[model samples]
Target: MNLLWLAVMILALSIGIFLFSLRWIRRWIREDIQRRQAASGKLNAIFEWAERGRQDSLRGLVLPGADLRGADLGPGQEGEPGADLSYSNLRGANLRSVNLRNTNLEGTNLEKANLRGANLKGANLRNANLKRADLTSANLRDADLRGADLKGADLWLTSYNSGTRWPDGFKPPMEAIRMEEE
Candidate 1:
């Protein structure tokens, strides 16, 4: 009887240890997966927040080297304000062909960013730093660029309508194209 009881006790201890080890392994795997997904630049969480119109949640967001091509973070339905990404630092970000129409980018730092084919129509870019950024083929129609730093920025083939505002005494680059208001 004593031997049988000892065996039962050992078996229970083993089962408990096994269950604890399994739980720990599962938790570790789940956390590792989350870290890998985020590190891979899959900004699904950011996209979900943007889709939900969580502007406050996106404040001062940092997404350097992120692939945000054709993202529509623009104004919502009529009368709803657009996303406000003021003062965010997105240096070296890949914003190629993104739809940022009617968005607010005031005081944002976009140095060395690749903004080729981006649509900034009606976007407010006041006091933004865009040094050495590529704006090739970007739409600046009706966009407000007052006080923006466009030094070394590539404006080749960039189109701007009459409503687009530039810094005082600033002239558009020769490669900039003028477009008719829509």
Candidate 2:
């Protein structure tokens, strides 16, 4: 009789532990799935907003791969492209592989963002902040940079084709010549 009682208690304890562990695992999995879904939703929202120019009225949104070709993005505008964007905030955004030709970005905030392999030919960037950003393989030909801050920014393997423009009366560095070889 005592042996039977002991066996029942052991079995109950084991089942209880198993149930607890299962719940914990399930919770973790659910949280992970939720995180992924949120990230995907944010990415989708950014694209959708760029297409329609309105989504929850998010101001100064960072849009990657947006075609701002001749879009008027001046001050007090709805974050239009290729307009005077001095003092505009764009921290930690992905502008990778974008065509920002002739866009004025003077004194803009672009900290810790990914501008990798982007085209900025003839764009103005005087007094812009680009700290800790990935400008690797990006084209800044003929763009203005008289007082731009590029501390800790990556320029590795950046691109620069012909007909590229520079800042006001400024010339590209000798290292920039390597882009021509590619």
Candidate 3:
């Protein structure tokens, strides 16, 4: 009789542990799914905003901390490809830690914009007005800056790899060069 009682208690404990573990696993899975869904929703919103900005020239548009990785912002012209963000005004906008890899920003007016810690790898900034913009610690690796005016822009600790393209006769700050060395 005592043996039978001991076996029942052991079985109950095992079942209880199994149930607890199952609940915990399910909860973790649900949370992961929720997080992915939220990320997707945020990405969709950013895409919509970019599209709207393209149509309206992004005048006075503000999209701080947007994750636009692999997004196309070139012109939608017939037979021409790329996400078009040309002729847009983004003055004083906060874009801290945002990802704008491979984005097209030709002729965009970004005067006084705050792009601190942003990733602009491989972006095209030909003729873009970036006067007084804050690019502290931003990554501009392989970015094309032909004709882009960056006068008075804060490039402290900014990263620029060897593949980075600059305007004619343009010189990068010492701090940016140091970051590349590190």
Candidate 4:
């Protein structure tokens, strides 16, 4: 009778431990799934119009702190294939390593956007509002910034060349470094 009692107690403890571990594992798995789903939803929303070759206007759009690395908004203009994101609101968005090459962003509101390490080569940003935007280490070679409102923008260690056109009479910030190669 004593031996049987000891065996039952040990089995109960083992079962309890197993059950606790299973619950912990399930909780973590659920959290991970939720995170992935949210990220996927944001990515899909940004790329849906671009992939479908739709030239829809993304004006006044709001998407802050979103991970938009290597994304292409579209090639600007009606004749070409791509979406027009003029006057869109992308404050505080994470645009690291994004591809805005040749895309038109005229009059777009990009205040406080994190454009670190972004690729904005040849992008048409005429009259765009880039106030206080963090553009550290970004590639701005050949980008057109005529009439762009770049007040208080951070351009430290950015890569730009002679082809990068600035707004009329807008002196570049002293921290903005020019690229050696044209």
TM per prediction: 0.73, 0.50, 0.57, 0.65
Ranking by lDDT: 1, 4, 3, 2
Model 4, 1-182: lDDT tens digits are 99999999999999999999999999999998887787678568668777656556655565655668777764645346344667776777788777676666778778888888887777778888899998998888888899988898999988888999999998777788888582
Candidate 2 residue-wise lDDT, 1-182, digit = tens = 99999999999999999999999999999998886676567556645654664323433444432333233232223244444445657777667776666667777788877877777766778777888888887777666666777777776766555555433554444455444433
When 2 and 4 are scored with TM-score, the better candidate is: 4
Q: Model 4 off-target regions past 4 Å? A: 1-43, 53-60, 74-83, 180-182
Best by lDDT: 1
In terms of TM-score, the best-performing candidate is 1
**Predicted candidate 1 versus true structure: per-residue lDDT over 1-182, tens digit per residue:** 99999999999999999999999999999998876677455467657767676454456766666777778777666545566777888789889998788878999899999999998888889999999999999999989999999999999999998899998888998899999955
Model 2, total clashes:
6
In each prediction, how many residue pairs overlap at the backbone (N, C-alpha, C within less than 3 A)? 0, 6, 7, 0
Q: What is candidate 2's CA lDDT for residue 63?
A: 43
List lDDT for all candidates, in order.
0.85, 0.64, 0.72, 0.78
Give the poorly placed runs of model 1, Cα more than 4 Å off. Answer: 1-42, 53-57
Clashing pairs in 2: 137-157, 137-158, 141-165, 142-165, 142-166, 144-167
In candidate 1, list every pair of residues with a backbone clash.
none
Candidate 3 deviant stretches above 4 angstroms? 1-83, 178-182
